[model samples]
Target: MKNRVEILAPAGSYEVFLAVMNAGADAVYLAGNMFGARAYAGNLNNEELIKAIEYCKFHNKKMYLTVNTLLKNNEINNELYDYLLPLYNSGLDGVIVQDYGVMKFIHESFPDMEIHASTQMTITDSGYADFLRKYNVTRIVPARELGLEEIRDIHDRTGMEIECFVHGALCYCYSGLCLMSSFIGGRSGNRGRCAQTCRLDFNYNGRESKILSLKDLCTLDILPEIIEAGVFSLKIEGRMKSAEYAAGVTSIYRKYVDMYLNKGKETYKVDKKDRNRLLMLFDRGGQTDGYYMRHNGREMIADNTKISKDLGEKKQYEEYIHRTFVEANPKIKINGIVTIKKNNPVTMSLSFGNIAITIDGPTCETALNRAVSREDVDKQLRKMGQTMFELDTLDIRMEDNIFIPLKSLNELRRTAVDRLTDAYLEASKRNNSHRFLPCAAHKESRNKGISVHVLTYEQADEAVKHNIQRMVIDTEVMSGDEISRCVELCRKNNVKSYIGLPRVDRGTYNVKSNSDGYMIRNMSQKTKCDKEVIADYCIYAFNNYAVSALEDYGITGITYPLELNEKELSEMDIDNGELVVYGRIPLMITANCIDKTSGNCHKGSTLFSMLRDRKNALLPVLTCCKFCYNIIYNSVPVYLFDKLDRIRIQPEYYGIIFTTENATEVADVFKCFNNRTKPEDNTFTRGHFTRGVE
Candidate 1:
């Protein structure tokens, strides 16, 4: 038989784990008490996780641990090994990783454990998938923006396993690249403490709407197509969701996956009853098919889902819980033998999975009353209730007239079961003992030149004319002949050019292979171009290990993560690293367009508006309507011109990003950066360069 696709579910707690497994998930992803992207979830502890693993193993399912949060240098150095060691030994099937440092450490130390690239990595294409293959990443969870064709192409070209999100809540910003919550409220999403700022209401052009909220994804009708595209795993995203939601979603997906597997493509059909149950379970706005079909369309927006918000739906969820979690769990049957003798010890031996445990109870005495009947012995032995095991068979070779206390039998059974449980846990154990090897340091940077990032050809022309010498053009803004002209203008002015890829490119990539190089804003870009790649900060080379790991992929240069402060930067080699010294840093690169929600769609024109938050700060919303994405920029651009003195180490270049700025503003910003001075007006922030993220 052909291998069936995996239906992966999320588990926030042990109860949810059981619900998911019983609902028919082939594998479940969960986080321990720490180091998971869903930090708010009621995650598992070490002991509970171990038990969860063993339970899955016993039930013929798999459990993948989520270590998919970015770690600080201190956390990696102090807490990584201790937190993961026991779980690794307890036979964790796989680990979903977001941090490159975490990936390298785990892969080198364990070597055999499977590493899955988490969606937080924002992987979008085959090249990015291939880049991770050397690090022993067995699977890639591509950014949700990728279409079916893109997913199939990634799998076919890379020959690596592809996993996609088929259903559940969708993030407004592309995963791994969001920093809005951190910038606004000092809670970092990359560190797993997202405040979900996207779900809140914002005023845009006098319209109050949840501008950043996207409808939950539902792909029930397209399961066969997704499977046909060679997606090995279909994942549901809800680690922070409730157990009822877990059971309901898992049960529906499981039923369909089995139906497809058993009935084949010709007979595969999406049942209407299953669809209605899913709709009743939960939805945001309504449901969108997501970016799987086309690039940017209004259909994907989840502006209003008030129907699912009704409290009456709570009863539906409870019914699902009752039907799934309230059902009886499967039991393990063991053939037990009990022996009783006169004036000697009575021993009971139990066997299970290559391990056997024998318990000796109080010695039997000569019968003072009627001899213990067979029915009495059977009834006592069959009380293996509420445990994983049941009394499938019980053999009694009792000494004639030997009397045994009823309490002793109960004690013998309980002891044997407890010992068997431990034996089973040991049988599923794995071992990891290797230590991490550190990378050698590089020389410090000697030069710090200025590079301008422009969003349009006009800006690119002006940038090169001003002898900026280096220009990064946003590809979403420049396309076809305009893109070619930007490159031509840069080359004519003896200015090196780099194509700034969209942070979330899901459609067919139209990158020119002839550019000098590609500024890789996301991992999925490398598969689009074979050019020598420059790593953008969104790729997150946060630690020395992450830098060394990416360097192995032949990446030419790196941009240190913007989250790091001066003290943290001083400790690492910044020779090849570039710093963003000036820019209205993009707070959000999101799919749910604030423009669409601001009722700007009826205008049928592009929108450039401001989202005024509760603080009364107006953040610029840059809409790439064609691409179906919106970038909400910080009200205060990140300007560290004066803070340059605090930076103990230097990088090859300092980058200034221009999103909404005109030619005059761009020139003024560059001049201030060049002179090592602040903007004339006090309209900028020293973002995370002096104070790092939490």
Candidate 2:
């Protein structure tokens, strides 16, 4: 028989874990107390996670832990091993990971543990999936924005197990590429402390609305298509939700998946009541089919109006779900035979599936008052209350006059159940002797130079006139001929020109070969391009191990992550790193176009849009028509020219990114940085240089 696809549910707590498993989830993914994406969720502790592992082993299900957040240098060095060692020994089935440093650490420390690439890795293509094979990543959760064809192509090329999100909330920006929360409030989404800024209201082109909130994904109608697209696991996205939501959603999906497997797609159908139950469980505006069919459209966005659920309907559904799945305690069935005879030790043999155990009790006594009957012994042994096991069948063989004490029978039953549980736990234990090898130390560099990244030729022209050593031209906005012109301009000024690839590579633009190096943002570009490569900050080199991992792929230059404070940066050995001293940091790289959603799309023309928050701050939105993606810039640039003395790490280059600046503004920034003087205006933010993400 062919292996069926897995229904992967989310469990924020132990109760939710049991509820989803009872609701028919093949596997459940959850997080421990740290390094999880949902920091606000009531996560399990180490002991509880071990108990979960044992429970999964007993039930023949699977559990994957979520270590899917980026780790800092100190966290990786001090806390990572201690945090995972217990889970590793308890036979954790797998781990969903986002950071390269965490991947490397788990691979080395827990060799037997399976590593799954999280959606935060933003793996949109097969090349990146193939690149991760070196770290022994057995499965990958691809970016949710990929279409069915793209998902199938990735599976066809890499042959790795693909996990896709079938239902739940969706992020407006590409996962792991969002820095809005971190830049705005110092709550870094990359660190699992997202402020949900996307769900808030914003004004687009003078029309005040929730422009960034996307409708939740619901793909029940296309379940067969998703399975046929080569997905091995269907993932549901809710760890912060209640147990009722977990059980309700998981049970419905389980019902449909089984129906499709048993009765083919032609006979498969969804009941209207089931659909309504899902919405009533937790409604976020309406639901869309997600990016499976179309690239993106206005229909995919939620309406501007608020959606209020009926309190009566919600309460009724919650009670039904709680009683049906949560309060209901499922037990393991056990068949047993009790042997009782006169003047012989009483014993009971219990069998649970293939596992069996026998327990001995006190010696049987002669019948002084009344002999113990089969019915009496059966009644006493059947009291398997508050235990994971249920007595399904029982046989008793008693002598003509045998009297067994009630206390002895109770002890025997308890011992048999305890032994069975112990046997399962012992069977689930794993041993690993692999030692962790730390990355080699990097030499500190004292050389300080300036590099400027430009979006337009005028910015590049003005940038090269200064003492800048390098210029990075964004290929998403500039045409091939325009890039060549910028390269020629840089060449004339004796500046090294580099091509900056798009933040999201949808296989549209080709790598320009005439540049000094390529500035890559994603792993697919990092693996496909054959040139001097500089890893962008979006690649997330938060620790030395991540930097070493990038270097292992032959990447020499990497940009410093913007979320790290100055003290954190100073602690790292940033010899080959480039620190962005000045720039309007791109807060979000979204697949949904702001112009198209607002009914003002300029077709294939690039235009600048504005998004005003409630605080009346205007965020620049760049619509890149070539790649069909949007780049949302911060309200103000990150200026650190005055704080250069406070930054102790002397990276190879001090980089500046010019996004919405004109020719004169670009020249003024370059001159101020060169003179080591602060800008005249106080509008610029210091970014995370003072207070880093928690």
Candidate 3:
């Protein structure tokens, strides 16, 4: 069972969920309406989600909810937590998280909640996987663009479970990081409602229209190769597909996986019969193996209609029957008067406005009902039965004038089957079942403190009152008296403080081993006595240099963003240092409001349209900070809280960060972290002074 290759499928709805599961999906991945990457699909609503979870557990299958959408500073709200808590508490196996902010919040809410880093994180290296392990992430879904070798390397180096996309659609940009949909359509893909604008044909002057539409990824041929590579799960990427499509895809993959495992990998092939069956279900253009085979991007597009096939001939009577039904009068019925005879034999009296006749016979019952005028009666008779008694008869026997419509009785039978199938299908997936541990609400931490850019006294006072234990003061405003005052105030309020200093002498800011605490800034600006001044204020900082060198200089903590490339961070020996677990990735450096020179409005705010091979994002100036400009594009928020296991960070040296404006949102993030931490552990601790050797 441990070596079993899991066939993961997409469950856009309960029906699709069941079809894929019954059709042979080992697991099903779905999303709630919010924060899911596939926004446009018929994704499960909350009530449906509850049923889906029950259904998965009943089938002994794993269900991974896709919380893998990028978040803005404003979108992280109390309502988000309201939805998250119940799911986590309900013995939900795992959450597929994309953004760091969501990861931070989930980690802070359910510290023990199993998290899988979504491919959206674009983690492409073993180092990245190793780095993510610190957050206790169960799996790392590597970027879709990775080769089989790359996936294996990551698997070998880091023992964390690795999931890879086996089949379905492929993205032109890197998975989980593409901004093309949001940039063009204002429909953010990270939110699960992506407008697939890439498939459209466009023209770039003089050239015949260029079809940027990509071929769907069908890796049936390489099933064994991927499984042999030690991939934990073989995921199919189609959250917004029809039930039939999900069934077809899942069935094909299931058959192939069985073939590869039971038979041999050489036995598997994508032949004409299977291809036709797949295309008959549905397709965008056609299918391809995609980047699973290493190649330049040129072959991404292939022959579009090569997959089409002739549908062959229909039955001779099919057309006539279909046309007759299509054009028939639907609102016609015949009424008859009823009578009964001796020996329990049923008789009918027909009186249609002064025309009366007596029909009495057990065998005559069939003939009498058919004598009433309706051309479509034969069709109804064929479906229901040969005789009136067999037609679910309701005997309204009377000596006088009561009229009963035979068509009306026939209509009842027809409606019953429709309702029965509809009801059964709906009822099939629901479960009021209970588990060993039902999900419950856990209180998240509310630790908000100083990340003030200006580092003013007013902001510092607010922090002191709010039990904000940490302050990171800028080196530009570094004063011994101000630092001492802040340190004493922190002590009085039972808070810890750190003065920020530039990394110069040994890539760290020096703090005295005596009073308060210190943070090391990685910014490349240092004066002659920058380290000297920091030491005078009892400040120590961790930066991009040797940890041993910083240890000698009494550097207390390291300040690094969650945006560190995993390979780059793995090369360093940061045995005991703090890392930024959560924050928005400031991915660009721009001249201040260069595009918004016109004072009237930011009407013509231009962004990076296209840069080299990478697509450009509209870097709108979301906010104006005193020193640095906070520009927001459709840039994804980063969450490393779930990746604590891969990163191997000492809890004391790990921290989650939010800008002053968005600090409150991290309340749930810290709450989840604090609840999971040991009573004596300071890993849930934050701020400049908390990163001391413990």
Cα error of candidate 1 at position 290, Å: 2.3
Candidate 1 lDDT tens digits, 486-601: 88888888877888877777635677746689898776676677687887788888877788777887778788788887888776654677788888888888766665555466
Best by TM-score: 2
Q: Give lDDT tens digits, candidate 3, residues 1-694.
A: 1267789999888777877876788898998877787777778788878766655544567888888875533244435566766665554678998765465556556676679988876665664443345457879898776778878887887887889998788765555544445444545455565677555544322222223456778777777888888797999888777766776778778887887777676666756666656656555567767666763244456446665544442222223323333222222122343343223333443322223344443321333333432333334433534211122332354322222355643554444433332333342332332222212222132323333221344445544544344555533333456666666776787765556543121212344422344453321122222332222111112122223333334444434422224443443344444455543333322222222322222332322221111233222233222222223333333345455554533333444333332234334445544454322222232211222110
| Worst lDDT 10-window in candidate 2 | 426-435
For candidate 1, the per-residue lDDT at 246 reads: 84
Compared to the true structure, candidate 3 yields what TM-score?
A: 0.48
Q: Candidate 2 residues 143-172, lDDT tens each?
A: 999999999998999999999999899999
Candidate 1 TM-score, true structure as reference = 0.89
Q: Arrange candidates, best lDDT first.
A: 2, 1, 3
lDDT (C-alpha, whole model) for all candidates = 0.80, 0.88, 0.51
CA displacement after TM-score superposition, residue 65 of candidate 1 (Å)? 1.2
Give the C-alpha miss distance for residue 508 in model 3, angstroms. Answer: 27
Q: What clash pairs does model 1 have?
A: 127-527, 285-304, 285-305
